[model samples]
Target: MTDDRFLYDPDTAVDPLGDAEATRAAGRSSKHNYAKVGSGRPSSLLYNYGPGAIMDLPHFTVMSTGLDDWERMWRKRVDSPPEIHAPRLREVVAKLLRSRNVRLRPHPNQPRKTGLSREGNDLGVPARVFPQWMRCTGCDLLAPLSHFGYTNTHPYRPDQARFEHERCPGRSGSRSGKNASRAAVPARYLLACVDGHLDEFPYDQWVHHWSPCPKVEFPVLRMVDRTAGKGASAVIHCATCGARRPMNEAQGDAGRSKLPRCRGRHPHLDAFELNGCGDATRLMLVGASNLWFPMTQSIIVMPRSANEETSDLAARIRVAFASKPHRLEKYEATGDLEGLRDALDGKLDGPVDEEAIPDDQLAKALGEALTSGESDEDLAKWRADWDPVDLLVPEWNYLLTDPLGLGHEDEASGLTLSHRDRAPGLRKEIVRVLAVERLRKVNALVGFTRIDDVDRVADLSQRMVPLARAARPAWTVATEDRGEGIFLQLDEPAVAAWEAQVEQDQLWLAHRAAHRRNFESRTSDTAGPVDAEDRLRPPRYWLVHTLAHVLIREMALECGYSAASLSERLYAWPGSDGRPPAAGLLICTTAPDSDGTLGGLVQLSEPERLHRVVSSALYRAGRCSSDPVCGMRTPQDTEDFLHGAACHCCAMASETSCERANRFLDRRFLIDLPGSGIGFFGLPG
Candidate 1:
């Protein structure tokens, strides 16, 4: 079935002949073939639903297949996917994955179809029906999809696709040969383990106690709702032998004892681990927010060379080569510039503006690509000493020092910056404000987790489950977003003095103790020895982090961009592991479109306007609608919560905007509250 709901472009078409090849490549059954079921923005694939993620469609519940399936589709020339290049992000992913030749490809996309015939627009990420079990709405008859008849009456409208119990004999056996078929819905509950294995809840075993039905070989099950509230009221009955059990028996602590162990099933891969997973399965609702947590890492594209022009030119050239690898290989083999130029000129197969590239710059970039080689030996050494914290250090230095003098706009690199003069009368705590006119951020989906999100945890490698079943994947999906931002740097001396004063405050100490307890509780299930540095946040971090959320809330009101469209990047550290103390935050908005949001955010960064905004934001932060209770609230000794004196009504930003998932935030750290002297900014007069 075709649906534009998930597609970036609804009218695009793929070659009809490629369908057979794609199906074979994906190793999917005829019923589970590709048909442009749905599509999503490239960015969504990174954060919301990458490979191995379960997605809910209008009429179906499906799980995105692994990278192996995606690669096969590309190999069959089903759709030509675009390659994204961000050197820093590439290096980080390489170290994380322990691979040298990893490629960053985005979701397949095509232009609108102009021809009369739209026979084949089936290009999209491959997916398979998950929780294969379905129940007939009319009769409450429960069975696998194979037992039901599927139909998609409108090929162009995926929402119309659905399953029907074509042979539904009505609620009672007496209504034989009656056409009482009704639409089928997926079973509400699923089974998952902390090890990241997901599978359909065991219906047959639950009713039969893991034993075969004594009276019949095949049991016909029915999930009958007793018209009562809660899951306990729902009953799974075996029509064959009359064996039955309530859905509640498969949930909670008691449920673990009643349910089967994880089968190590990765439905997306259409494969299972050889050895069964020993972890106990926990019952989870299908639409629960905690079902899938994407573990993605993104980086702002930065210039590699001291010369901005050279760096920009090189970036363009690399992108051009990445889209056409055969030409890149040909050039690498023959070392012929003329031949490469001729190939590029023959057809604008890649970026349309490639024809406008200067010959000198092209030659320079080609020379660098050939010489760099990107050897595995060098990568091995780099990975050996790699620290995730170091990723922010260079970015911190670049935003503050501006060592490369990158104040000019560069369209090729997608980086435009102009330093705004800080007013002498501006707040003393704020040291600098720079308008990031244009920026490119590349986000790559490395892995994901289920049950709990490891957003702030340092050793993500421990909990993160692979996208593909392979020990090593050749490439992962990624997308590049071009946007703008406002960078703010806090005064170091003032922040340091505040940090010193808060060190001995009882309230401050209580917050610290709360954090430690929270960290220990969260990581209690983790295997290895936990490091305090990995989970603990310094007081300086809380100050900058809380301030970012406050300013974001204020800016969103006037910036034309909604709060969800804005995002924050906090650069806070207390000079650890040879890295200097850093305190800053970037409030930015990005989009998949070529031209990002208008300059509303940057306009707010003007010294005069910024002073007003910060003053208002601080004034508002000092009091919340949920205050008295909110203002007085502290992370209790027994609770595992991270934030102190921060809630949705006050300092908390949307999940998309806050990098820490709204953790390590407190208005008391940013604005004065009652008797709290820990606030960095005084209440506005």
Candidate 2:
């Protein structure tokens, strides 16, 4: 019988490698010992001795002469590919790929020839035909068989390479897979300034490509000092004292030659030392923020210097009026500055009391409200301040000095208390989410680039951050790894912190609203009123505060807050603690802002955003409130607004006073302090 196993029929129409061909390697037959048959088997003796027997032999097997000869003839190195060491060889090739960036691709169909796919011209070897060709996945560049460095495991043969990831080291960097380029551009993706406010890198400002964490949408701010790594940061020597200082306040070595904090507690350098440095090495100067922004209101407060008589930052600003308070007397008395100052400071002789009346002033003020003629009358009566302090007195009695931080609101804590604590503690997390989302919206409005464009995202985010800061600069954000990412967080803690800043911003807005509304002209001026000049009119600081309100609200809406909410949050009277408390009655909303200056293309009108902002402030924490004047109504009025959210109507006695009234600070005394500089940090430069 003829055995066809191990057959190598080259030119035949019938292929030996056909699907129906049975594998003879695994069968047990006399033909399986074809390589050993010559030792003793009849098959080997008969097959070799008789020429007729040759036709009966297996198709591809030949008999061996002896036992050793059988092994030798069947296992020649030239006869078989190395399959036993396949696993170990694969490992070696993998290691080589890691070390030398080599990859393999066999010629298609295991042929011996192929061409390269790389950009540069590289010739490939032509054999029978390549089973595969080589390709450099890194940089998407490829090379032919001869170019790659061959090693013990990775058959340096060109057709044996595999696919690899394309490495992109960016423009002007390395041709290798790991080269990062040197960049002189602004090394930040997102910037948070010293004020705890956030800004981002604009296209014009960002030179390096932004590569933020794919997982973290809002990247935090970080910075890598080149000097810190290369050398012990550029040493700054003082000219006169010759004092050597390192820069940046994050590290203590920095001095305040240019930076005030670096200068010293007082941060003042004598001319001799200034002459020594001569700007050769400008000492680290304390600034508005790590990131630059012009005209931001978030103040960088200085530490109050001791051993000085006038270093108090909280100095009573002398109520200095660059212009006269817009009182009726200012127009009538030809600017009686002396009389006006005396009346405002409570210098009139008569007891500060409301006059006996037919309620004539209210009637006269109301009658004037209809025609816009009384706007001037309304303005006058509004300014006739029995005592601006009186309106503030009720507020002081209820402020919570000790604040319970976010989340852990226990009994007596600001978060759990009823009235003493309040103000929507504008959480950092809240602000960040809103800022990023709003940036996308603004980008949509302007139509420059998509929300995902790293450059555009950075720019829009920065421009819209003032909305979160609400007129104050928050933090400065820089990038880590030079310019690969962003670092945005609150800058330095204000002497008052975010809570106080919010309160002050809101307070000034209210005070100014009252002031602006006071200009109405009424038919008759009430007599015996603490003199005509002592009106509750807005002052310069108040107007400045109102201006801040306008800007913040505008930005917040551009971010997508409802107009009503925006106005309400902005309107809410923040308590000592930054969250809104029971002072709902104190929330003030007078008139909307003046028309937009940005032409017809960009009209900033958002009633809902304003309302939400104000309402959020009102609901921070309070037992209850009933201020019909502002139309702010709280659902609960018995518990402290900053702490617990209890229903006072159902739980507490109706006649109970709010909890905050009992814990009020001696604000009256604080306000009446004789001179300036009472702040933790003294007045600014």
Candidate 3:
């Protein structure tokens, strides 16, 4: 293994929150970079410290001296703090009870050691029985508790799991309350395979720190390209400990997503620093989990005041209480937020203090926020609507964001090299992934052309109606600058110019052929009627596929997904929890000046890829000549192109380029930069 010291120089002192001059040094450097492409050692060794750094070091020695121990301690304390011992809790209870002077009324129905609330219910559960519950400070037995295993104060689900003294055993099943409480989070939070397969310990073990991450730092090896354009932050989990957390609260501190900014200084931050684990226990629980392992990064950080935590928790609880609940089943099944609201009855307006808001009304409001989804503004409406006394603390962020732990990179292997500009390439990969999906969808459209299966043809035929009128149609939302002026948007304006274009372009071959084969005999190679001599080939299909990709990309941009995120959203084609780049439909933008010089351009919305290639024909003249304008060029240029125009493909870009004019405009390719064009509009591109 390479010198561990190189990769983690805790001695230099790093302020991840940017308190000090944010230190940037190589966490580990190599004279010969095994992580690079040509390094003969193979990229897999990079996780094992490449040829220069240690990769697969067992986390057992994480508690060793220096920064590695600091990281280890940071992970353990942040993820799963040492389990509170029964005796220790009892002492705290004695102290608190002694100071408060409270008397408990005996209930005849309750068990011997079980404390009861006003209602005849168990108050505190033993850690063993309710795996999520805490140990009772006064009683040594498992009592029904309210805090563990998150509960909805009202009915968010059909099954009302909450009670005045509700007890729940989460993922860990228990025959008795005993087993649930004792099984604290395991020792190792992460599991990394030699092959680079990393697994997290458990979802529930993570503490969602609501704070903005300044920037990722590594003393030895910061990804050289991280300071480029803004993008969403990743959810990085510790490879050795499996402790996981998000790098930022809202897709990085950059205003990339629509979420409001979260405010707070790093609270759970380690007071000290530990670079690595010091022990070999793969899985251990209880405070004893720290016995062999040195408290490497233990800084003796001050605990947040009860007022701070309580107020924050109470505010979150209020938001949850003010939430509108909706049916999750339909939301997942249909992806219809409006329909989901209707099914759940949405949220009701007005006051709740009138003896008044019916339980069903409260349930409706909860469903509105849950199913319809809530905005930041929806959170402020907690006054007079919710009771802090009976609040349900939900993972509000989780419910709002599409998915959790997404975009997280690997730690051990250090999969993140200087590939910052690779997002466009990532978009291309996403498109490729989605293209396969579109092809898969063709299977459903197979064989629908035959006369008997002809009835089903109307389903697709109805789409043709809108297809016929697609050209020059007005769009709902308009982008500030139409990409038509530049080489990117002006290409191939007639992708779906009319109903006939689909057939003329053979856009539906896969789906049409697949659906056609389903019902009847395949007679015509063509599905719907089209112009003569058009054949389906790879180049031809790729051209259409590219068009489909363009459409998806345009729609994705409109739907609030950035070029960086296009690939993420399109890769999976989100059903509910996930957002698969929006390949649903496309929005066509027609520049008013498309009169032959740079005719119309077609933009596809919700494309499947991140880096989308828009093909617009250009000539030595520099005009974006698409469709009929192919005839505008002389027949001489036609000899080379078989149509006199050159097919020029560009990604999303702004401004126009003139190549043939006396003083030709040189199209400067903006390297890793997003877009170097002048003006604020070009900044985000």
Candidate 4:
């Protein structure tokens, strides 16, 4: 059986703040050799440790290999990796990839047996030993992994997998001692570029300054740590020629010139770019958070109307026919299903999986595909047109209208919603309340970045590092989570009036200016010009975002759920081009399992209970132990900060809960800031 230590439980491994470093540290320090070493939840593969990411295991530092490697490895196993079904997310990713044929599969996780052998069962995502350099702990001997001896005492226990410096002589120069073979840890440092190329630290080059050793062709080296607190305390010394250099010398602005140009290497892929990247290399620690930042897109799965489903099916059918022009011509000539049926019988292959599709739906989709006259180019154009905001518009409409009504359930889509009456005393503010009894969320990892978290939808193409050596990937990795939530839509008229009132307020103006400055500062390093619209945030957004945080904090205390277990989705976009404005938030929790969290959150959506929660949340938002100072705080004159009248003690929610990462929030927008007249809610006597 695969050791329990190798399996990652999503519920336990993923940090609420989206940090995986702590979990990795736990795996590294595990006392049991059979304990999990590379264990993490399936969600981690989609967020914190996707392809090309460097991961620290108990016995080794490894890099998740490219999708090409994953495919090659999985092909060897009998069972294919499980596929995730989220049409909306698939459509978005298909558009991003500019390919109609795209699939979303999660990392392979086989069910464990008590006494099963690991032999011929290495069926998980593939990872390679990274950096390839190791430092012997006992003798300070530094060399490539080739020079070390490897051992896996328990083949079934991956945690016991380790590399050792077998012939190491201790500091006492005694080779026949128990300490002759010492454990080797990965070299602490690595090299990276903004372009996402990663390479081993240039230890030899750094020590010798790009010159050959004067004493020998290949010098023996030692990384000596002085046990001091700073990077300068670590020195790389050549034992052959006595050349030495401190690690701190390779940091900051001064260090950029000392390092070589990027070789455009993707160590995980074991390949290098034909024309190397021109970007300069920077020194990075192996465990630095900036070394890998996953670029992911996620969406809450919503039920589609019958017509909408038919339309999507028709599009897929058209894409299938577009690949086989002869079949399309035959169908167009006959104007019937005879040709399509023949093609289907012959096992036509395309985006539409024939096995999963029903005969009736296939027939209806075929009729629409032939009549719609959607050419291959037209289909491509349709797939190319996608907007991130557009994904939310349908969801917003569904929550408000509840056209499907209460007790509505779609087994295929995994969506179940029941519209509840508006809470008492909140009718004027909250227009609708929805008990989202069941919902599915799909998260997909497209690419990753080095040294920065670039998540702008528009700039994703330019900023994201490719997952494969090829220009495009055949598929991306994704995972599906099912859970429940509570949706609250604010009255648009009330929200509009409040926003108009705050638009001209001095405090709001200061926050807006800070938003602009923050955007400019972040985009300053990019080569492209910044869009003016990207710097602006409507007052409604700040109000809705802040209200969500306050509500989340209050809901966590009242409900059994912890603050980290809850997440908020804001629907705050201003009206433009004849579209209506939206002001709402959805507080929800989800898990990787089929049977989601117990309805602790959905139960709180009852009218009387919700009324109390909202009232208490607003009352709590107005006062804070850190108030007076926090209340007076504003983002004005601060280029980096984007929040005002918001701090950890009050408006800021956990990083996983707040969509903006705790930005664009202000208690002053939700409740009056001391003597200010800007609050959206007034306390009752």
Candidate 3: misplaced stretches above 4 Å? 1-500, 504-685
**Residue 129 displacement (Å), model 1:** 0.5
Model 2 misplacement above 4 A: 1-232, 236-685
- Model 1 alpha-carbon miss at residue 605, Å: 1.9
TM-score of each: 0.83, 0.16, 0.17, 0.87
True lDDT of residue 21, candidate 3: 19
Over the full model, what C-alpha lDDT does candidate 3 score relative to the true structure? 0.22
RMSD (Å) of each candidate, 1 decimal = 6.6, 37.7, 29.5, 7.9
**Roughly what TM-score does model 3 have, to 2 decimal places?**
0.17
Error of 3 at 195 (Å): 12
Worst 10 residues of 1 by lDDT: 1-10
Off by over 4 Å in 4: 1-37, 78-81, 113-120, 172-179, 314-387, 403-405, 455-459, 638-640
Lowest lDDT block of 10, candidate 2: 435-444
List the global CA lDDT of all models: 0.74, 0.22, 0.22, 0.74
Candidate 2 lDDT tens digits, 115-229: 4332211111111101111222232222232333321122223222222223324322445546422211112122222212222222111111223333343322222234433
Q: Which residue pairs in candidate 1 collide?
A: 6-39, 6-40, 7-39
Task: Name the better of 2 and 4 by TM-score.
Answer: 4
